[model samples]
Target chain A: MVEILYFAWVRERIGLPREQVETNAATVADLVEELRAREERYAAAFADLSALRVALDQDLADFDASLDGVREVAFFPPMTGG
Target chain B: MDIRVQSAPFDFGAEAGAFATGHDNAGAVVTFAGIVRDDTGSLQRMVIEHYPGMTERALEKIAREATGRWDLKDCLIIHRHGDLAVGEMIMMVATAARHRKAAFEAAEYLMDFLKSRAPFWKKEITGSGTGWVASKDEDEAALGRWSKE
Candidate 1:
């Protein structure tokens, strides 16, 4: 089980702050593809990757990174940190 | 280390003093406070919204990274949420180190990362209407320089 989280406008667009999913996603990109196929809301929330950023295991990371054994994935806007 | 995300206002002097305690060898303490400014001229108040779990984790990561990069004895970060009046304290960062340079640089680095890399969002209450505060490209550029340097 992998915990997926969202923040900022991404959360507002998806209408959820977090969810747990079972997946065979090899990488973050694969998980994103799976999410985009889940529902219109997910697709709309992830329509533009350029406007989004990803963190794997609570650290800033690229989407191409593998998600094997990863327990958590979080998505948010290009962080306005404070 | 202490990290707080709350609606209450913070006292900078008191917070800094607390972090500097129990470290007799620490010779310098640097503090940075971000105030709710009506810099946009049209903004009357600001509402800061954040994801509860992820926001706290993100802040902790930033603080940890700062600790890794600098030789620091202690650190404190406080961020306010919900509605804020102009000139109210939005965030405060305090760092204690053996030298002035490390304390000052680490404090600045932490603020830079906090401003551009955190998950918190702001909505400006203006005469026009309440709208999300747009993140500036300049803030990203500022943070990018740190990585390159």
Candidate 2:
């Protein structure tokens, strides 16, 4: 099981902050595809992967990154901070 | 190096002063504070959201990179979260170095990286509605020069 977190608009669309999911996904991309298949809201949130950024275990990571032994994942849009 | 991510508003002048005094041997100190800007004249406030643990780590990494690239004596980064009105200071970066050039350059590097790399998200609440602030392509483009140099 891995903890999945959503932020900003992603959180707004999904209607929650974080969740624990049991999955057989091998990579971030596979997990995304699995989440996308869960429901329409998840589909909407993951509709365009390019519009999102993902962090694996608190470090920025590529969607194609392997999920081996990963405990936490967070998804959000590109930051606009300064 | 010092990094602070909090929802509480900070005193810009005081923080800047302390940072300089803390590194008296440094010949130059540079500080930059980002203010909440509402160009549409309809903004109510800006709500900043951040990933708690990741925010600090990302900022520290950025600061560490700046120090590695310059002769920095000390560095500080303070970014606020939650609701902020127009004209309020949202964040500040201070860099101290042996010379003006290094200090200025390092401060700029921190700002550019913080603009894109930080895990903070800003949402604008306006009279009409609320919306997330879109990340600018120009901000991403700004980093290209840093890597080349």
Candidate 3:
């Protein structure tokens, strides 16, 4: 199971901050597709791929990147820090 | 180098004074602090949320990159997460180097990276409601200038 996390408005829309999902996905994009298929809330949260940023195991990563051995994935809007 | 990510308020004067004092070998020290602004006049507060583990890691990475790019003697970054009232400090960056140009440029570089790279989000709470602060196109464009060098 991989721990999936969401932040900011994505969290609000998804109705939770994090979850553990059992998946056989090969890449981050595949995982996102799996989650999007599970429910409407996930679909809404991930509707626009370009508006979101992904981090794998706490490091920024591309959606097409492989998720082999990855333990965590975070999805959120572009950061507005500093 | 030092980095702090916390929800508590920090004393800017004391921190800046202490940072400058120990860097006597360095000829210049520059510091920049960002304060919450309430241009609309109705803003009650701004709530900041961040990915805890990743936030620290991202900050360290940015700081390391800044130090690597310049001849910095030392650097410090302090960012606050949580609800903040108008005029409250959101974050600060300090850089020390042998000359003013390096210090100033390093500080600016840190700010530019911190704005977009850090995994923190800000939500503006006003009388009407709350909304996430949208990322500006210009802010993303600002980061492009650093890559050429």
For all the predictions, what are the DockQ values? 0.52, 0.92, 0.96
Candidate 3 wrongly placed segments (more than 4 Å) = none
lDDT of 3 by residue, B46-124 (tens): 9999999999999999999888888799999999999899999999999999999999999999999899999999999
> What is candidate 2's CA lDDT for residue A3?
99
Q: Provide the overall lDDT of each model, using Cα atoms, as 2-decimal numbers.
A: 0.84, 0.95, 0.95
Query: After TM-score superposition, what is the CA distance of residue B90 in candidate 3 from its true location, in Å?
Result: 0.5
The TM-score between candidate 3 and the true structure equals 0.98
User: In candidate 3, how many Å is residue A38 off?
Assistant: 1.0
Interface RMSD, in order shown:
2.1, 0.5, 0.4
DockQ sort, best first: 3, 2, 1
Task: Give the CA lDDT, 0 to 100, for residue A24 in model 2.
Answer: 91
Q: What does the lDDT read for residue A37 in candidate 2?
A: 94
What's candidate 3's DockQ score?
Answer: 0.96
> Candidate 2, after superposition: displacement of residue B13 in Å?
0.7
Worst 10 residues of 2 chain B by lDDT: B16-25
